[model samples]
Target: MYDLIIIGAGASGLISAIVASSSGEKVLLIEKMSQAGRKLRITGKGRCNLTNTLPLKEFLKHCGSEPRFLYPAFNLFFSKELINFFEQLGLKTVEERGGRIFPQSGKAQDVFLALINEIEDSSCQVLKDTQVTSLMIENNRIVGVKAQSRTKGNKEYLAKKVILAAGGESYPLTGSQGDGIRLAKAAGHNIIPTLPSLVGLKLKDYNQERIHPSIVGFGVRNVKATISLESGKKIAEEFGELTFRENGVEGPIIITLSRQIARLLSQGERLFLNIDFKTALSEQELDEKLLSELNIRGKEDLRSVLRAFLPHELIYLAIYQTALDPRKKASFVTSQERKEILAFLKHCQFEIIGDFGYEQAIVTQGGVDLKEINPKTLESKLIKGLHFAGEVMDLDADTGGFNLQIAFSTGYLAAQNAEKED
Candidate 1:
């Protein structure tokens, strides 16, 4: 029997195998896919954002909920350890904007290859096309896993200790099909409500023909996006790029707000988002600036004048929403019309009706709740020798390498702790 059996060879499983094998323990990494790291090859548009170079406290802040649960993992294998781990595997990393770390070669495949090479060098057995069907339990302890080979058809194998790094239900194409959650539930583990995270929101507006041609591929950067409830209470706010798509917004800012929006929508709450287009400018400052521009370029067409302050498509749409004519000159514009334009710019609001589903989500928000797992070992409090890591555990962070760091940290910790028991 092997010392450790890691289910799923995604980021966490791969790292766990590497760490456990390094401890001189025989490790078997099982992957249902033909190759390891199917999802890793597509991360960060194939560049593979490995980790964020931010300070520890700042990095923890990006983790929305249960950031404290990561204290032990982060202390053991933080961003610095992750960078060192890859460097030792001969995969050099470079930091980009916002301290996002990527391979110097700028290929996600290279990152995956390095991890595979490390596993190989550690004498770890890679069992590809091996789908784990269920956990093998004995006396309330996870003794092994029952897995079947996809090619061999129904042939099963058992292992000594199982680590469930099977990831959450995000990209089903990548083999994250909620099998781990199913296995965990059967083993009497509590799973949190799974929901889509880091996904794009779908708007309620039906004027797609009008909005699509105008704002597709358009992105607003360094702006504040505020989500408001039906009672006009601010739910969430973020500052980053909000990319406009034919479907809806799908950028850093939009993705960060998506989880909260999805939860609200699921609860039958009518949600609205307001973008502070010019967040850097105060209301009085913007008014003064607009009045100054008007004084210098007096009596020009209202549309032409406003075009300098907003996107042409947004200007036209705002004008339409305000019931103002774009052809009207500044001299013909009423004071109320100017006020409407300013208000719309500062608080351009839209109703969020739904999300784009799991395919577009970067990560799943909820999974096996962290409360049921020992934070230090990533082992379930309810089961002995059954460890959880990565997206499968109810831990997610905003974009910018925080999530990847968590994956590596928890995987490393789980492997180390599992090896200690061995």
Candidate 2:
């Protein structure tokens, strides 16, 4: 018998094990993957974005759905505490652009190494390649878990408490395949319909056909993007760098907006993406600049002059949209052509068919609802001795380390409450 059985050895599960074991609780950390923290190692493109240095209020705004639900846990373990905790663990960290925090070593492997090494030193029993099938609840009270492993086959492990920190259903290659959501649902927890977020949105293929073949990976920096449904209802607008994908768009702003758009799309909403290629200038201002460029370079080919405004490949799309002849001299360009160019630059629109889906999504948008879990302890209100943590709890935040912070904070809270006096 163990004091606590923590399912899924990802960020939350690992943190739960550390906190519980350090509190002198007998712990058994189970992971279905052959290696623990597989997702952690590949996060932030292998740099391991830990947490942001943003103030609590500002930070909460980046989180999805109910930000209020995190108040209790963040109050207990916010970014400052996270930094100090990692520091105490002998992993030095650095704050980068946008207050994003990462290990000073600049290697995600180092962070994972530090965490798993700390786990190995603790009295907690580690079980890798072990699949936890279901909870062994009796009479509405918590008991143990039924699990199976290739070496041990099927077995039941009884525990005084259990922490479901199995993460969300994103990056299935890393072992986050919605096992936790299924377990939560089986235990009678309400699940918010899951969707892929922080992924690429598939734009209408017509936009690609208009552009040159070389434009597939073209990047447009510092642009404003507006999202709206086919009904002409505006969904959102944001400004950030974006890269043109073969099928659609991806980048910081696009990925962030993809969360809400995905949910809206699942409800049968058709959408459109409009990018302001020249966000720094208004339509009038851009017109003046375009005319000024034409006056100075009158003999240059219209396409050649456009190179000053856009990338070599993007110029083809601009020319196509503006209906301007590439061979035409800047001096020969008509006023109507200039007007078309202005509109195209300011309002480049594309139909949003769908997103790149879960495999490409950086995080899962929804999971087990938060109303069913205790805000302070992360314990499931429906079942005693059953706690929830991390992405499994219908909580996910934008990029820049917010989601990982949620995992760590909730894991700490769950472990803190689950521990019993020896």
Candidate 3:
């Protein structure tokens, strides 16, 4: 028998085991995958944006699905505590744009190594290639768990406490395939329906030419993208670079916006994305400049003249949308055609139909409902000795390291509280 059994050796489980073991508690960490921290090793494109340096108040603003539920966790162990924890483990960190913190070596493996190293050097026992099938509860009190291992076969382990850190169903290859939610459900906890968050959104009736090899990877910087309802009521707007993918739009801004867009689309809301390529110029200013450019380049072909106004990859799109003859001389261009070009540039709109789904999403938005768990202890209010941490709980945030910090804070909080359990 152990003092605690933490399932899923990802970010939360690793931290939980490290903390619980540090307090002299006998802990057993179970990981279904062959290796731990699979997703952590690939986060931030292998750089691992570990946490944000935002103050408490500012940081809370970026979280969703009951951000206040995390107040207790953050109060106990926020970004400062998290950073210090890693630094104490000999991993140097640096802050970057938007207050994102990354390992000084700019390697996600370093971050994973820091957490795993602490666990390995401690008394925490890990069971990889073992899948926890169910929570063993008697009279609404947690006893232990039932698991099956490829090498060890079926096994039952009793613990004084259990921290369900099994992640959400985002990257299935990383072993985060809704195992926590399933276990929580078996233990009589309510689960919030899960959906893909921070994924690229698909456009309705998008032109096939837009995703051509020449344009799929093109990126436009300093553009403003807005999401609005069919009634023109604005929902959200973000300003940054936008990337065109084979299926739809993506990038830092688009993925951040997808957190809300995914839910809105699922609700059958009609949404549109209006991208302003010339955010710095007013309509009249752009029109005046267009007239001047067209007049001065009268001898040039319309196709060649358009190169001055838009990226080469987008020239075909502009001409296709405006229905203008590419070979026409700039001098022969009509006022109507010029207006069309201006409209396309000023307000390029795309109807949001769907998202790229969980397979490509960075995080899962919903999980075991927060109401069923004690915010202070991360323990289930209904089941004693049963706790939750990380994406397995109903907590998600925008990019820039907010989500990872949630995992760390809640993991630390859960372990600290479990250490006090009898």
**Model 3 poorest ten-residue lDDT run:** 205-214
Residue range 260-365, candidate 1, lDDT tens digits: 6666677779999888888889988888777776666677888888887987867756765576877877777667877887888788778888788888889988
* Number of the candidate with higher lDDT, 1 or 3: 3
Candidate 3 per-residue C-alpha lDDT over 72-129 given as tens digits, one digit per residue, 9 for 90 to 100: 9999899999899899999999999889999999999999999998888999999999
Error of 1 at 107 (Å): 2.1
Candidate 2 local lDDT, 81-158, one digit each (tens): 999999988999999999999999999888888888899999999999999999989888679999999999999999
lDDT of each model, Cα atoms only?
0.85, 0.89, 0.91
**In candidate 1, where is summed lDDT lowest over 10 consecutive residues?**
203-212
- Where does candidate 1 stray beyond 4 Å? 260-262, 288-300
Pairs in steric clash, model 3? none
Segments in model 2 whose C-alpha atoms lie over 4 Å from true places: 206-210, 231-233, 295-299, 320-324, 420-422
> Over the full model, what C-alpha lDDT does candidate 1 score relative to the true structure?
0.85
Q: Which pairs clash (backbone N, Cα, C closer than 3 Å) in model 2?
A: none
Q: Give TM per candidate.
A: 0.93, 0.95, 0.97
